[model samples]
Target chain A: MTDVNSVRPQARAETSVRPEEVLLPPVDVIEDAAGITLFADLPGVSRDRLGVHIEGDSLTIEGRILLPAPEGLEPIHTEVGLAVYRRVFTLSKELDPDRVAAEFNQGVLKLRIPKVEHAQPRRIAVQVA
Target chain B: MFYRSLFPRDVLAELDRLQRGMQQQGDVSPSIRGTGRGGYPAMNVGSTAQSVEIHAFAPGLDPASLDVQLDKGVLTIAGERPGVLPPKEAPATVHIDERFSGRFRRVVTLPDDVDPNAVSARYTDGVLHVSVQRRAAAQPRRINVV
Candidate 1:
């Protein structure tokens, strides 16, 4: 119980979110034997407004969504006022960050990271005597 | 080691899911101002001097699959977001699944001054934008006095 309680706060602060109102976009992570894939939903964000960066073992994704209100338009109804999305993750040492690949479409970003050769599983052949 | 086994990453993920569910339930209170609680594809409506613009932030949807309708003074946006999860038999393990999927629909009641026939809708970068022109008489105009 002590171990769980000690780790709970760290897990909640996994993304290192700031105090300001920053929209944390929902994300999905899938891991296989080969590598891991991450998917983030970023609606209203264009390709030019998105930034993905990797330094050391830290991975960051940032995007800005600016809703265009034509001149003389007054907002009569508003639900979502969020304009920025930011998330960060500490990659595992077994993953190869240099080979990361990313793709964006329909406001969704997909990132793929492959495992290092030494970390990948290999089937060894046994000699029959 | 036993305590470590007791609280694996999956347990934390389950707790996160539960927290999100609770928060969403809290947002479902019905309001006359039309703010949806925990609704998919959140929307915003604004009016200009000549037109009313409605924007729905919905990603991961095909433009052709979206259905928009304007009847009387109500505008409806309906669409389906396909699930991106792996199959049960796949060897992959999903650590997180937070994106909203499946079918969703949002309805907005426009003002009486809008012209139903002059409405136009378009989908770009996963956002559905609908613009409805207001009636010419409803727009404010200046008159010169002698």
Candidate 2:
């Protein structure tokens, strides 16, 4: 089993001065023979408001969720407040960062990271005596 | 089990603290206790003179598959989300799986004055907006001053 801690990236200091609170979006990371796939739930985030960046060994995802209040309505109860989503993950050498692909739809972001050629599993041939 | 047994009171207190923290963060719905998972799809409920509006933050769900029903002043939203992994490919191993999938249903009771017959819903981006008009008698009206 791969040690997740070894490859996990550390969060950098907050530099932006945005007033909105940043939230940690829930994510799922799946690793197969080919590579890893990451899915993040970012509700109310549109394509223009989503950002995915990779620098050095860190992968950062940032998104803003905007839910405008309707006119002439009074908020009686609020459970989900508007906020920004921000999270970062570390990348391992076994995977190729250049091959990463991302897709955003219906408030969800899916990222595909392909493994290096040698990192994939292979079948071995038997030798007869 | 052994740790809990050894520090029963401490564990209970810690659990209570954590619950309180989660509640203060508004991450978990009070109705769904013990689920412990933070809000998956946060929601907001508001009211106006003529109608009540409910907004549920759920994305990536098939619009056609989304189920919204109102019965006896209770509104229920249910749907299924397929696994994020590609269907055709077989995964050799899974490292970190945190995303919640499968089917889920959330039911909330509406105000007694809501008009069940007058209801409309729309799904945009990932938010689900529901509007239900209030009963005619329940609507506020101006009174004439003699």
Candidate 3:
């Protein structure tokens, strides 16, 4: 549907630089009649370390892992290095950023963005003439 | 009645899909650089003179649902992450679905000097940390010069 295409955001753009690698956390975006809900998996990131920003039509989610090896420990085998998680998405014009709601649990971030009142679905009453 | 070909296009397509799914599930390769191709819950294993620490990055899981077991010098971490997608019938369009779901298990072989009886596991902030203490005899000691 045309509406679906209009509501779906484009792929994220990476524009940050750091010594360590920046990882793109896996995300799931679901859109219903009311709005769109985004779920991102960011493990080892505490509440204070996580940051969500909305500027213009762009939405950014950034966080850094806070779990570090204890003192006197040397890495014998490592598969996941200490890295940063960052992703940006372009929101649709129909979505209302001011009313967005977010929740974090078990290292997962959930963001709900509702559509503007005029963009939402409405039923029209029919009358006999 | 019309006869259909032996190798249908849809059947071949389905087989291809199955093969791709299997390959994605088993994409993990052992490396120290964290190549970023390892399957769900990337892990880091480190060791100290007293204990060996392992951290698994797995989010959106109930702490009670995790299973950590060490036996015969092998440590196993297993858990399932419930899917967060909406129902199929719902009038919802999924733009991107990249998060991992379903049952996942990772096994690590511990050194012989580790004391399995002294292992402890804790899950916090969606990260699972497991520590196994090493035997006293295996620890390094400082020698005095006379």
Candidate 4:
């Protein structure tokens, strides 16, 4: 069996997130023949504040969500929810860095990475010639 | 994410009282506030031939109040959701926290190939939609079609 102890530290860091905090934005993963698509909700987020980087087999997304502070007067009994999301992904061999792309709209983040062409199934054509 | 509607009867009643209370306290009060996440906003992301599309769920936030910017491959949205209730003389009471207000900001990084200049954003049905087109050279073309 694979050794779980070897990767225990990495897994702990993710769950060690603060108690009052929530998980990074909820991410939806959809797979097709091409590759995987990732989407996350990030209300009040914008292009200037978003960041994405990939290293080896790991991809990381970094973002800051500045809670909207109420206007006028001191924030008495404050409950402004402030948040920042940091998520990582372990890519499969099908991933191709050269074809990776990302976009942000409103508060949603999207990523598209085309799979290695050879990894996809071929519509095998019979040779009539 | 679900932010309760300020228009709901219960929320409306509380808002009315909050407005009155604010007036008494001499504070320019906000019309609404959500105690928690207000559930969550719905989001969808997809791509087209020339661009990628991202839609966020924020009902009270309109396009006019929304600000978008792109830099260093990152997309950011920042804006204020002004009090939606009509100006009132009474102080405001926030019994139900459904409306999200204040200087909210959300940031996202685009792919390296994005042509920031080609990015466009729109709002409809309280949903903000953004389209970021890719540079022709960045997208691989079909070499052969069977």
Clash list (residue pairs), candidate 1: none
Comparing 3 and 4 by TM-score, which wins?
3
Listed in order, each prediction's TM-score against the native is: 0.79, 0.75, 0.78, 0.41
User: Which runs of model 2 end up more than 4 angstroms from their true locations?
Assistant: A1-20, A121-129, B1-40, B85-91, B144-146
For each candidate, the DockQ is 0.59, 0.49, 0.60, 0.02
Of candidates 3 and 2, the better by lDDT: 3
lDDT of 4 by residue, B29-132 (tens): 44243222232333444555567666555645557767888898877777775543223453332222334446776655566788888987877534576778
Off by over 4 Å in 3: A1-20, A123-129, B1-37
lDDT of each prediction vs. the true structure?
0.87, 0.81, 0.87, 0.63
Each model's fraction of native contacts: 0.86, 0.77, 0.87, 0.03
Task: Please compute the TM-score of chain B alone for each predicted structure, in the order given.
Answer: 0.76, 0.73, 0.74, 0.59
Q: Taking the tens digit of each residue's C-alpha lDDT, what string does model 2 give over A1-129?
A: 667644534432244346557878878888887888898988878899999999988999999877655678888667665578899999998888999999998888999999999988898899999
lDDT of 1 by residue, B33-91 (tens): 44474588888899999999998989889999999999999999998999888999998
Docking quality tier of model 4: incorrect
The lDDT of model 3 is 0.87
- Interface Cα RMSD per model, in Å? 1.4, 2.3, 1.4, 18.1
Ten contiguous residues minimizing lDDT sum, candidate 3 chain A: A8-17
lDDT of 2 by residue, B12-64 (tens): 89999998887657643555444323454567889888998988888888889
- Whichever of 1 and 3 has more TM-score, that candidate is 1
Ten-residue stretch with the least lDDT total in model 4 chain B: B31-40
